[model samples]
Target: MARIAQESPGAPHILIVGGGYVGMYTALRLQKKLRRELRRGEVRVTIVDPNSYMTYQPFLPEAAAGNISPRHVVVPLRRVLPKCTVRKARVTELNHDEGWAIVQPLAGPPERISYDYLVMAAGAVPRLLPIPGLAEHGISLKTVGEAIHLRNHVLEQLEIAESTDDAELRRKALTFVFVGGGFAGVEAVAELEDMTRDATKYMRKVTPQDLRFILVEAAGRILPEVGPDMGKWTAEQLRGRGIDVKMNTLLESAVDGRIELSDGSSFQAGTLVWNAGVKAAPVVRRGGLPVDEKGRVKGTEYLTIEGLVRAFTAGDNAAIPDLTQEGMYCPPNAQHAVRQAKLLGDNIVRSLRGKTLKPYVHSNVGAVAGLGLHKGVAQTYGFKVKGWPAWFMHRTYHGAKVPTFNRKLRVVADWTLALFLKRETVSLATIEQPRADFQLAALDDVRPKERAADQAREPAA
Candidate 1:
């Protein structure tokens, strides 16, 4: 048990976990709907998340490619939700029976927070498999940090290849392998490919032909969100650019910079990115909530947990039943997560007012994906679009969907600036460990000069 935080005596508290799309949007909606109660001190809205900002995940690929500035893709929670109390903490445990949750603060001890109502929207983590060496070598693109790291890493590889005279070393440095073919994997690879190709123009030794970009998919087709025809077209388009689109293939191993495929082919590559899939965030399962087999919190069509009236869930963490699809839960994607959040917010308000709740039902809106600059694929409103038009649609749709008008304008401004300026391709990998050199210098200063001289003068045994 944890010590309870101080709170207002007469106000009902609504505690929301996670700061992703669902958590941020739901809190935004709830604050707007419950404005009167909040002003009167009848209710208090509190949100707890490890990050102070909500990352718009759909733009991660573009962020990785330097197409959009990383800072513009995330919305600061404090700036957006001034009325709500924002805690930078992770919900470590949930005890709904006692109406309190355990939160681990960013830099301190765990504390207990009692709530009248709870909303779980912690989102998902990368679904990793037991493939050997994957834990050591595999990287993902789930967060802004990861996206920025990947951009730096990809550029670093190009630098290595450009300077290397050994053909094998050059080959290994230039080869990039991406696993999975979903929207994340496809878009990430495509955008990075575009950036890398453009970057090679500045390198004297490296050319587009020298780069090897391989995409491995276990499924027969890629981008299942779009129909099979579009998936096929997308693969063909990738191949047209000299990318190896290996369908129905499995990555047998990526051990020690050596990649082995099920097709009996192997290669040494410096970069290996894994975007296979996502599972519900561990906090959901570990918090003792009732969850489905896939570890998602079990919820009704109204987005409330089965046995708990005050507990609600949405987004990737919740197994929301799809009324339109028989024997299937809603797919854990941005499309469903954003829609469910809107309805979940409204339902929470209705529940507080003692009104009948409405079931969440939204027909599938088709999918759209960017295949680098001036190239994309989209299926919306029973129509299929490809090439530049699809690319424009992708930007337009996501630009509108990205939460907060300020962020939308910033994203638009980034795109506008790109028209006249060349894409920034310099690697800033040092940003990951920005203080290492300073720390080392400080440590060196602390050493005794006489002891250092004695150690240096001593001969090896």
Candidate 2:
């Protein structure tokens, strides 16, 4: 099949198994460092991923709320890594002994890919619990499609509320519950709330007071990484905005349209976004490498697979210990991922040149989290900052870390334009059911109603 490309002759072929922060950055660094070697056919690099683009997940909430254009958040693989071959495929399995990996490409049969050097950067996926009906109704904002879907869904609910007299359904649709209170959950809910509140000016039926925004966290604190005082202030700020901050509350079950919580609250809500945690990609498990207690591959300070020195692993899928923090593994955050990738790239080249590899050890600078417009909480260098300063810090730090200059410029431009323009609240939630209207029209001759009683109490547009 066209999916199977033969390795270049007489060159050391490098295979990158994922196109996430670790995969893209590692390959990007390698191509830059080994450009002359690659041109002379001394080294060949192939980057295989399911998608041709790398998503900047930190900007996803802004994208979902239309604070930033979605296009600006993803860097196309072909554009940045021109010297490296980017293949659109999922690494289904790996064979370290055979020195080849199995790739399942879209629209073709699976094939085996050979390589002299292997980089396992297959990141993590959203962890799902066995909660009932979640698989069917719960929406995720992990990818570009997911973010766009969320944006459209939120706006559609507003439209539905404006057009319908069915108060119960409207209420259900407008009520949004976020399962986790960590970064993704908090950022997503806050940005969405900010956008929806702004959009309420256009709707008579749906007021800012009508929307129910719930932030559910099982732990005692919402932003534990941030200090106690700042975290409490964040909760208070959320409360000031009329968000239901439910800490130490557990979601017992969610099936059909009903939800039951461990706090003994039961209700019906149409929109649910789960951002609780994540699990390592399945590709890492099938790769036949050394993984730790968790499903991540165990890597040395050099990010070399536990015992296999040539193969490297990083990002969320690698269980590299935080040697500084006793009995603790590195928390799978982007801060660590990018740093590990940088080291992984440097170590790979050093190993080839018969140079000593450096150990992976970093003293965490602290954490920063954005909680909607001009509201954030952060902890850095043993100091806490909240409100505007924290929010600014959040943007500044992420702007600096968001990969290539092209992407950085695009993101900065998005933020710059956002300063002057209002957020876009037009959600195309109906896209989820593009054919539902057609089916209804064919079967029952039914179309969506969007009318309200006027002066004469007659149906008016």
Candidate 3:
């Protein structure tokens, strides 16, 4: 019930849940455009999210490869949204009828928050398959932490490969399996495989030829964000890079480093990275919002939740009506999310001011992916570009669109320094098992008593 001192008798308060792409950007624009409303103490904005930062997911592969620093990929929510109250918590329940929500605050117990307007931008989560051990063993490469973990795990595999004398164990440890063929999957394998290759130069026993990189897709092709032809070409290009592309294949089991696949093939790997796809965060449907076939909030072209007058939904959480194609919905990508955010903001303003809200419409501009340094594939506007141009396009496009100017410059600087600097192959894998070493040390301290008892039981000498 903590309210900032801007309460007029009947001022409108906006409660934005999920400070992700749509929430952050919409509030930012609202804060700027509604400055007078705030100065007059007539309107206010508040944002809530589980994290204090919004992750730029497209840069995760680059971050995993150490092309960009992990810290710079996150935009601090509180720092940018000075005009709004930023609540670091998750919304557990929504009471839209009463204009209130129960928020599980990051620091304290659950509490209530009331507002005249609501924005649902809670975003998405990693979609899992029914395959055994996929949930427990598979790591999703969708966050900054996950990217760092992937980098560390891949490097740890290399280290293990270098020390192991058993050829089978060595091969298994060095094998890296990625189950997905979209941008996240393709880029992740390309970047990490490149990193492994570059790292081999520093290893005494390991080489690029000894490492195995496998990209698995359950469907006929990859990168459905683009299309079949480009996706097919992308697979061929990946094969050219020495990566095994398994189409129409699915991983069946991965229990204790043993793996089984749909093609009756088996292998062992120390690392399993899953980037299959994304489903709208489960909270979206649980919030008592109108959901469609895929559990995404059904919304009109205006981006408002279909049945609610004061509530709106955007980003990956909303099943926004796709005006471009018949009986379709917008794909969950930053391209549409960022574009829809602008109109979401504008429409909110119009709603508050009793003006007409505009419709949301934007066609897919295209997709650009970074394979390795000076290597990528892009098909846009009925044109195909590969090699250096595709790589450059990938960099330039994401560099320009990565949210903040501060991030933009950092990404640019990373690429610029990359030209003259050798790739950093060092991995901080020990972090995953920090406590294991301590446990071993404690066990070593206690083993002397057991050894003495064993010697006593033996024949006197």
Candidate 4:
């Protein structure tokens, strides 16, 4: 048994793990519903996460394309959950039977936290395959860091292509390959392509015809959430922009910046972005909870673990039954995660008060995807829309759902600013290692002094 932290007297402590959509939304609802209890010290809410903020993942593509600032895409947890205790830590082990969880703080040793109620909302991570050299060459867009890196890397590649005189080198530098055709992959490629197109006007040598964009998907279609017709139309739109969409094709290898596709085709490219899919965060399994075949924690429609009382889960980590779709579980997406979190919060409160718990049943609110600025595809209320109107809807819908008025205002301000100012394409890659120059100069200074002192000491020789 783990050594657990002492709990506050006369209060029911609620421990929420992960600070993503489910964690933030659940804590927000709890704060509102249990306001009296919280103020009176009758209840305590604590949230633990590795990041101090929750990233609005939907805006990541826009951030990558410089359409939105990276800082604005993430909401600081403490600011949003001021009523709750926010710990910058990772939940390493969970022993629900003992009513304690092992939390490894960002700077300190692991400690045990005891709770009357536990919620597992730890989100998913990028699912990477064992394709040769993928781990070395492929970039991901799942996090803000990756998005920023991709933006810098793509711009840097453009610079390289422009400066190079060799045809082979320029061709390799200008070629961009993206794997997976899901929302993330599609949006990331489209947004970056748009940025690249706009950036070329500033470069003397790089032209629109010189750049090549290729999207590879192993499945027969892309954007299946928007139905077959919309998916087809979206593909057509992408192809019209000179994007090569390869369906039913797999990336066989990416060894040493050389790409080999399943269709017996190969090429050299400087950039490779992988956005295939996501799997439940590893913390879920470490918590000792029962998981389904897909490695998701198994929970009832009420978002409660079957054998674990006072324990609930939602978001990408939980496998909750979908009543609307027979014999199916909820799809791991932002829409479901957000709704499930609200319901889970209410259900937890209901359970505490001996009230009837409501089942988590929510039909998806259709799908919307942006294929770069002023271009998008969306399906809502059984109506299909595409082009500028769809793009507008996509931005409007996500802007509304991004959480917090401050962040919403900032996002809107970004879009508003984009109307008047040119898109900022200057790559600030040096930010990654800002201290490198200073450190190198300091080392050089010390080395020369040391060498002169050694020469004086060896005057006789």
Candidate 5:
């Protein structure tokens, strides 16, 4: 068992699990608000997550489309929460009743960590269904790494299609399919299609007409985050750009590169991007905490786990009661995550000082999504905007909310540079398998040596 480093032996220790919006923002707030307590060893905050950085998911589509630099879309936890103890690990189990958790570090065996307070901000994971070949063929877009890989993959497919002499191979390579039509799926397909169209201009064999982009959704309409009218308009705009918007359709199967849709449609696509949905992290279920049917930790209006003491949760992992609406919980989105984090930090500080905890309450601000360059949809405070204005709103809102002036400046600079310069379409697919070349070279050298040794061992003819 490791104590995870506390300055005072008896002082209260806060063990925060996860480094996403909730964990990062909560720790950031604690570090600032409890500066004196942290310095005096009165309270200790320790954060554990597998990654060292927190990725901003809204810009993933843009990053994938080369509109924003992949490096700028993530915030480093160590740099942001200097006052808290950040552990590069994942909590495998928890004993909330005893205030201890089992953490498995990136390279070390599992260790028990005792805490006075536990924050279950472990975030969410891709909600995969039991579909044939889905696991093997489908690519996801939840992390910055995945976003980068998708970008390289999209460009690589174009290269393959352009270079291939076989029409079947070319057709398959040029066809891109995206499952799910929510914000992530719609934006990803739209942005990538836009980028691909621009990329085709630079290719001699590949034209914009030669490429195909298809969006599959199980719902009746796309962009349910916005108003139905706006969603319809967005769908229409997408179709106008030559995209195949197949609503009320599901990806029944994706065996190898063959796609089978629920609507009796079939096709061969080289790229299959899956953005179906996400559920709370599995750790929340394993922790023995009170979780809802969907595996999210049941949170009180105060943002603490129900029927538990000194244990808190919010964000996608918590089904926190929405004070603004009857019988409704806060939606799993960045807006609530950021807002709840502030209150969660304050409540924790109040609890330490024997003050009454305040409940978290916030109204829906609205929703905004970008559909490629100069195209978007937004519904803020009841006002709906589309096209260029909505796109501008999407950038402005996310740009301001992306945390830290450094990242904001970098994102804005990327947008600024895009206005004057042509989008860079170079594909660095080799980065995914960086050691492949080195391994092949080593194998070649060993092959000759092995051949010589075999010849030397054989009897003379």
Candidate 6:
């Protein structure tokens, strides 16, 4: 294997994989705590990720609804981690026992890097099932790009419904199906539905009633993060908004946009969104590391991977013991991910200095979700809240947690400007294929020249 060149071969190097919440926060804390060591070349820190930026996933629903700019939802990793080496690459394999890792860059051969310590924060990917036609027809909302594409696609569907004369085509174009009823699924359907309803007012043929939004959940309730009562309340609110909330139902198939539900219902929808759940990233399982049945790296309360020396983990991919609840593990969410990362960073420093490591402990705060403009539900501090107050709380809580003062300012500014101006409903579909028009023109020019040459050679026609 090829070796990555290191500037300080003698100093202890810390390698952090994945630039998500856990990876970014841990490295940021390390940079500050080990500032003197980093400056003196006594230690080295490096981070690797496929993308140059770390996306704040909470604002994705709003970005999909055009409430916030896509650029503000992601923080540039290079700008934030100026003290550490940030490589835009993917870690293909890990041999923690040998203290070496194989990483594949964007456009090059794989290279192996040796590290004195390893921080596995590789996060998770969408958990998909074997439902027929799902791989081909369903859309995901994991990244900023996906969010942008979904927004444009929804508007395009409305345009199609407005222009089509056939009743079947119009009906298909007007229907949207979303599977899963968790926070991401509920918030996404609500926001996009709101945006679509607002856009219909400007259309000549398409009316708000023509749009059909469906939410499917196998469980009997939605938003289980909150209590069952709140979940039922949220579902009722969605139904009141003219959305079809189907509980205790499964999506059996979606062959060519014809959806078959386990509840004996069928429909044709132009759009299908899948937000069921997510699992550990594939790379985490590829490595010969100790993982539980759920494929998460086994970790102790100190944030150190069990059965491994100088190895640490945090985030959705790590199965750390939850102190608040016996016989249970930490739930995979942004709340725990952020807190574990800070403790992991401190523990790493403490280990290096031969100090006692601290355990990860944080009680459950609560759950909050926004269900369109001035509509939401929240449960925190043994109290329940809904309606506009819950919406305000959701905004306030997440607005403070999005990381970086710069990002916080931009997010707040987006909300501030939204109050004075109307929401922009125009879709820029051409952005997805900006070069299509140029390619078509070139093809047209070539066809004319070819036809003229052929006629001249044939001497007539």
Best by TM-score: 6
List lDDT for all candidates, in order. 0.92, 0.85, 0.87, 0.93, 0.93, 0.93
- Give the alpha carbon lDDT tens digit for every residue of 87-133 in model 1: 99989888888888999997767998899999999999999999987
What's the CA RMSD of model 5 in angstroms?
1.5
Candidate 5 TM-score, C-alpha based = 0.97
lDDT of 6 by residue, 228-312 (tens): 9999999999999999999999999999999999999998999999999999999898888899998999999999999999999
* TM per candidate: 0.96, 0.92, 0.92, 0.97, 0.97, 0.98
lDDT of 6 at 38: 88
After superposing candidate 1 on the true structure, give the runs of residues whose Cα lies further than 4 Å from its correct spot: 439-461
Candidate 3 TM-score versus the reference: 0.92
Clashes of each: 0, 3, 0, 0, 0, 0
- lDDT for position 117 in model 3: 92
Candidate 2 regions exceeding 4 Å error are 1-4, 430-461
Q: RMSD in angstroms, all models?
A: 2.3, 6.7, 3.6, 1.6, 1.5, 1.1
The RMSD (Cα, Å) of candidate 4 is: 1.6
Candidate 4 lDDT score relative to the true structure: 0.93
Looking at candidate 2, what is the lDDT of residue 43? 89
Give the per-residue lDDT digits (tens) of candidate 2, residues 136-255: 878877898889998888888788788989978888888888989888888899888998999998877789999999989999888777767777888889999999999999877778
**Ranking 2 against 3 by lDDT, winner:** 3
